[model samples]
Target: MYKAKIFVNYKPSVLDPKATVIQQTLTRLGQTNVDSVMVGKYFELVLQGNEAAVNEQVAKLCSEMLANVNMETYRYTLEEVEA
Candidate 1:
């Protein structure tokens, strides 16, 4: 078995409105230490496959559907899990 941890986030060049709102809200709440904020997607999945195959599938899914390659970037960690 394999475990895949996926993270999808906007590219640095892209503006994140939600994150900006969060930062602004924090500042209003008297949290001026905040410099920036970025929000993204995270998922944990377990697959019944070899490490290589699971990694390939996760990569494909992230690039093709989970994230927009033009505006976002994704990274995953695949690890063998005893099942």
Candidate 2:
């Protein structure tokens, strides 16, 4: 078995309104040390297959479905697990 930990996030050039709002809220709440906030998505997938095949599938899924190639980037880590 393989475990995939996927992270999807916007490109730095793209403005993240949600993250900006959160930062503002934090400032209002007296989090003066706050510099910035970034919003992203994290997904955990358990897949059954060989490492090579699983890696290919995970990459495909990240590009085709999990992230928008034009505006976002994705990365994943694979770990072996006992069935």
Alpha-carbon TM-score of each model against the true structure: 0.93, 0.96
- Point to the candidate with the largest TM-score: 2
Tens-digit lDDT string for candidate 1 (1-83): 98889999999999999999999999999999998898999989889877778888998988898989999999999888899
- Which candidate gets the maximum lDDT versus the true structure? 2
Alpha-carbon runs more than 4 Å astray in model 2? none
Q: lDDT (0-100) at residue 39 of candidate 1?
A: 100
* Pairs that collide, model 2: none
Where does candidate 1 stray beyond 4 Å?
Answer: none
lDDT of 2 by residue, 1-83 (tens): 99999999899999999999999999999998998898999999999999999999999999999999999999999999999
For model 2, give the 10-residue run with minimal summed lDDT.
30-39
Structure candidate 1, residue pairs in collision: none
